[model samples]
Target chain A: MITAERKPLDEIIAMILPFKKVLVVGCASCVGECAAGGEKEVGLLGSALRMDARMTTKELETREMTLERQCVYEFIDRLTGLIDQYDAVLSLACGAGVQAVAEVFPNIPILPALNTSFLGQTKEAGLWLENCRGCGDCRLHLFADICPVTRCAKQIFNGPCGGSQDGKCEVNPETPCAWHLIVTRLEDRNQLDLLEEVYAPADWSKKEGAGPRKIVREDQQN
Target chain B: MKIESQLKNVLAAGRFAVTAECGPPKGADPEAVIKKGRILKGYVDSVNVTDNQTGVVRLSSLAACVLLLQEGLDPVLQMVVRDRNRIALQSDLLGASTLGIRNVLCLSGDHQSFGNQTQAIGVFDLDSIQLIQTVRRMRDEGQIIGGEAVSPPPYLFIGAAANPFADPFFYRVIRLAKKVKAGTEFIQTQCIYNLDRFKEWMSQVRDRGLHEKVYILGGITPLKSAKMAEYIKNQVAGMDIPEPLIRRMKSVPAKGQRKEGIKISIETIQALKEMEGVHGVHIMAIEWEEAVPQVVEQAGLMPRPTV
Candidate 1:
């Protein structure tokens, strides 16, 4: 899922400084699962801003709205009627959510309250580990279900680079070496010989095209 | 005539190849590069010009390679993936090649956290292995990394770094084999202080018959002082300095430590020269350039082979 973390208070404050009234938008999808931009987070941010406004010379009004999923137009339509009451929207979803709000209401400004971190999974409460690079080519089957593309620092399929120690990465000693995990898993699966087979350099054309990515299903479109 | 570099020629002729590192000074003084190049001129076959080795900003490795060329020293332009995306790295590879730099060492550089500026963003668009294949494609197939063909291609003899002491030691040689498979012609290992571990690594390399496929250059950096030895053994990552070596450095008084360092380096080089699958010695006399000639002469590698 697309994961993100809330922006710092000062940065968020600066984003909504020009607006006298703002809607704190939240999503119930990936960002909600990460606890970064859920309904609870929207209430906390709205309360914090309201409290901060009480201390300042200018009075600021904040409204809270949580959508089922902020990335879709149908869910985002929940704000169409109430959006005119506020000057701007402070979206607490991933980057996609901010765009969704802007696209739904083109006249109102949409400010992202969280920085989208990565395509990842929550390992435990408050702990998220990146698991995908969206390289468009998923070769996890070849490597015992481990994604070296996202975990390895260099993103080289032929690695563990020389700095890998005790199955830990040289870049961050705390992080496990992605290739080590792959190799050990392969060994356990009696596929050690697969390590000898070299892989071609990743093709960026399919992974990163000239612009943004798109997937349109003609069957589902109609 | 098909060979593009003197280092390649030495390796092709089956002679013990000698290469050392020359870090471009942080400041804008070309004289320092020239001085270091001259000191290592006849002592080593090729000098590796480091590209912001620890990520602390220095003279660009590309520019330093050009300066070393003016000094009549064969410069092995060391490029790290830590600082460049595919566009910049490939463009620099072509630029360095056209500027007469023949030998290129592809490396995934040290983490930026180790450098002076900790806030820098690392651009590891392609790791060392992929960089090797990318350069190979450009040189051999006249194609860019994006699969676009170009009129003129850059010719280069590619090299990559290896570390025998790094953990999961069983996989070091496997990784080396992988790099060789990725088109790396030569391999310069991380500094060798623990000979037993390095020998163990070489045995694995022999078992896989990787030494025959690629020229393996053992890295040797003389320990200047006991503090340096301790710092390397404890502080440095991916190094394997045994407790005995560290104790030996401490055994010597402060004044005699440099001499002890040189002696240890010479002895290490001699032992490595006799080892099977060991192609040559890459003496990385960091900052002590003057000590290099003496070490090379004393190690009986004085008359470098002129192939």
Candidate 2:
């Protein structure tokens, strides 16, 4: 689930105040799951905007629309003819969806209503915790499904640093030591021997230093 | 009753208590908060300041409510335990009490995934019912959630939320009953569009003797456009927009649709007021606070009853 907190009502209102007709677009995928840019939120935002506009001099006209997935071109294309109906578009999707809207409708001014945070999973019904960085690499197989890249304060590739205390990270005592989690999981699975493998220093060049990365699936391509 | 005695006296006089909702400013803008407070001042009995509403962070609800208090409005600090554990929730309640914001509406806010940070963890340490009970226990017994006696436990007129139209209506009502048991003095339902269904549920509430225990406030948010109406029907759970209403919204001249939306809301509120167990209506115009006064006036509700 893509978790997003709504930008403050005033900030969002201020951004769209200059526009006459605004489309409050919501994403039915992640933003919907998180409740930020979902259909309900779109209605709530549109209602709020309408109320705000009524209070102001402009008396703006606002509409709401939600797509199945905002990041996909098919969903973005759904708004092709509808784009002209509004002076600007307020995308409730993640950053990717906002960019997708911008890319698809280059002429329309696109504003993001949510600050896209991170790749996470719903621990329960409404809670989403960051679990992945989409680092273009999978090291979880070695670390018992815990990604030190995300959970570790240092993003260390090797064993626990001296800072780990009582299974908690010393950097912030509230945070659990990522290496400790990894060790615990390995120990549970009776794969603690995996920790014996002295891995070389991570090649930063292959990760952050590699710049923008892409994968071309020849099978899926025409 | 101990703390709400004064407000109860006002309610007993057959004067409709006015309650307004103030959505927290998205940013730290005192002007917006103050402006909203001023707009609702003297018109509403109490103003509800929503907490990180819908899991979206704005200015904190407590800060906004405190600001409203400073602005001379009786602010009902809306609290959601979705993001906080009992410890933090109790602390915030204590903080609100110390700040002299008396009224509180406890809610299990929308899932954390609904916000901009989709990956944020939700700490549903306590659901709305438990939260209400916790507040009651603290107030009546002067004890923390762990049963430890606290010096000078805060007194609050704790409120809870319900969705009569939420699917599986029986369960929603059951939960409402649970909330009443947990010490919810007031039950403000989710935005209700279908009055017949609401009336039916209110009848059930009456039958169960739930209405006697708590004041039931029907939630109403006006639909501004056909698209907005459709979103409510398709997306919002426990919310239903009758086809006629949707068709009416669509039939309106493009420019006149907003007026039509307001009309529908007014009719809903008027009809809801006629329901047997319905005490008052909680108008959640979302950002449409301006329309709220108009809706209330059109529905023949006095802006504020004379003391």
Best by lDDT: 1
As for candidate 1, its clashing pairs are: none
Candidate 2: tens digits of C-alpha lDDT, residues A54-158: 877666888788999999998788898888988999999999899988988899999999988878887887778888877666778999999977887545554
Per-model lDDT = 0.88, 0.77
What is residue A222's positional error in candidate 2, in angstroms?
A: 66
Write candidate 1's Cα lDDT for B1-307 as tens digits.
Answer: 2245878888889888888899999999999899999989999999999999887999999999999888877889999998888899999988988899999999988878888978987777787888888888898999987689966899899999999988667777878888898889899999999999999899989998998888999999999999999898767778888999989999999999999999999999999999998899888988989888988999998798887
Against the true structure, candidate 1 reaches a TM-score of 0.93
Candidate 1 chain B: 10-residue stretch with minimal lDDT: B1-10
Residue lDDT tens for model 1, A1-222: 899999998899888999998999999899999998999999999998888888786679888989989999888888877999999999999988898789889999999999999999889988999999898988999878999888887677777776777788877879999988998998899988878767876677777787898998999985
TM-score winner among the candidates? 1
TM-score of each: 0.93, 0.58
Per-residue lDDT of model 2, residues B188-276, tens digit only? 88787777787788888988899878888788788889999999776554466788889999999878988998898888877877777
